[model samples]
Target: MIDFYKYQGTGNDFILIDNSKDDFKANKVDYAIKWCDRKFGIGADGLIFIEPSTKGDFLMDFYNPDGSQSFCGNGSRCSVAFAKFLGIIKDQTNFEAIDGMHQAVISDKHVKIEMQQYGAIESIGNDHFIDTGSPHYVAYRNGVNENIVEYGKSIRYSDRFKTKGTNVNLIAEKGDRNIEIWTYERGVEAETLACGTGATACGISFAQKHNIDKGIIEVKAQGGHLRIHLEASKNDKVYQNIWLEGPAEFVFKGVIEDEN
Candidate 1:
């Protein structure tokens, strides 16, 4: 039997397991593929493992539904909340991920995470590309009536990103400080409720295109809403101090008796 927790951040759900004692010995990739199956298993966008961290409060190991390593934005926030539940962290904590170290603050209702810095965004044709922990292709999309899956997949598997692949996001500016985004995550290979990194990328990219240096943008996704704050260097093209803020909730807790 195994114990697990279900957590979600703005509808980006994950199956979390405490492996501090190395209790899980099964093949992680195979297990993720099985348990993340929507119909057959726990059914989540991804899986997260919490292990003791010598570098910080804990280590967040994130895997995509396809069993690939990833640094998920929403999943990372959920990990911070999970660490608090396990009594390993307080309101504010730092954790190491596949990408690097990250800091987060847990309030009474929301989790705000400091994301890594990003370099200049590359503009190709009508699209833009940036790596916000994960690679994302951003395009300004107008209106809501379109085939998201087909359009996103075409860009996701394009020859330019055939090597590592990239997440696809279609965004439309709604107001001066608000935008609506739809993301087709690379790992999930489909449109999800929301994507943290994708939202962050879109916000920053939009700011750059508009020549805005620093500000906050409200991103509305299918799952929920997220706030992305960005600061850019006037002399340099790099963007820094990016923050992603949203809600993280505990859905349920359970144990799996079938060790299959």
Candidate 2:
């Protein structure tokens, strides 16, 4: 039996396994697909293994709900919690991701993740294009009808976003300093309450388009509220310290025998 812990950041949940011994690396895809099943299994956005590493604090091996390899922002937040739970690292740690090395700090109520900024900013009509670990196309306007389940997925899986697949978001400018966003994730292929990387990408797009100089922005998602801090350089290089601040709790801890 493999022991695991479950954690969620703004509704993007994950099943965490302490594969610190490196004995559980095999059969990752099949394990993720089965363990992440909604009805028959624990139901999660992905499965993460905190593998023991000599290079970084720990290596987070993340798998999407469909058993595909995908980098996740919110899932990384949970990875921080899992690492802390297992006493693998201190309150702060360095992590290795598919995109690059990442730094995450665990606070009392939230996890602060230091991520790479937008690589490219393009305009697709009113939408904005950016890559925050993962590629995202941001479309922000007023009166989106709030039926994000249909609306977000249409873009999330549309040809433009489909070939490689992209996460879609609809943002409503609630206040000058506040924004409300609804997200449709690619791997999950559904409108989840919140998306960490999506929030960061959208926030950067909004800041750039508006030519605003604010560093802190409050982002409200369908699941919860989080804050983003933006830092940009004179040469137009964007750097960000985004905090997906919310309650992350240990929902359950148990073990399951490998069926395969």
Candidate 3:
């Protein structure tokens, strides 16, 4: 039997298990789809199993709701919280994600995640393409939820990203330093409340498009609010510290002897 905890960051929720001994084998996609079922199972956007790492503090082996992906950003934030809950690390922690090893710091209520530095943002037809550990299509709009899903799905399922459908993010600039965002995750096939990497990508992409320097930008999502702090860089080397601060309350803990 395995004891697991549920955590959510701005509505992009997940099921987490502390597999510190690497004794768990969840290599099947059907398992994730079944476990992530909202009505029939634990109900989450994805699932994560933490294992002991020889290269870092921990290793986050994650999966999407569709039982496909592993490098989920919001899931990673929840995993950080879970790791803290298990006393695996302290205020600061480092873990290897599917993309790579990520560093983060846990405050009283907020968590500041230091993401990896990828390449410069790319411009698509009417949007910019950036990979915040996961591919994202960012389009600034006056308001989201207006056919954004319909508009984003074409791109998400298109040959460009069909193999691993990309996450769609719609961002609306509020003020000089605030923004409202809505996201459509690939695996979940809907608009989730918050997307940690999506929010992070939009924050920096917005900064680049607007030419804003270092500042804290609020990303208001359907689930809750998240804060992003970006460091303006020259020569397209922008670095950032994103905080997916929101509810990570425990929902329920139990054991599943038979994962059927």
List RMSD in Å for every model shown.
1.3, 1.9, 2.1
Q: Give the per-residue Cα lDDT of candidate 3 at 205.
A: 83
Evaluated at residue 234, the lDDT of candidate 2 is 62
Task: Encode model 3's per-residue lDDT on 1-260: one tens digit a residue.
Answer: 66778887877778887889877775547667877898988888888888888878998888888887747767777788888888898989878888887888887756677765477788887688888888888887885547767877877988888887788888888888788988888888887878888888888788788777677777888788888777776655456554444445456686756442
Top-scoring candidate (lDDT) = 1
What TM-score does each of the candidates earn? 0.96, 0.92, 0.92
**Which candidate, 2 or 3, would have the higher lDDT against the true structure?**
2
User: Which 10-residue window of candidate 1 scores lowest in summed lDDT?
Assistant: 230-239
Candidate 2, residue 198: lDDT: 88
Which stretches in model 1 have alpha-carbon errors above 4 Å?
none
**Which digits, one per residue and each the tens of the lDDT, describe model 2 over residues 173-243?**
98776898888888777878788888888778778776766587688888788777776656343654544
Task: Give one digit per residue, the lDDT tens place, for model 1 in 1-260.
Answer: 88889999889999999987656778889878988989999999999999878898889999999999978999999999999999988999989999989999999869999997556788888788988989989989778666778888898888988779899999888988799999999889989999999999998888887777888999998999999988887644468889999999999998877663
**Full-model lDDT for every candidate:** 0.89, 0.79, 0.78
lDDT of 1 at 203: 88
lDDT score for residue 101 of model 1: 94
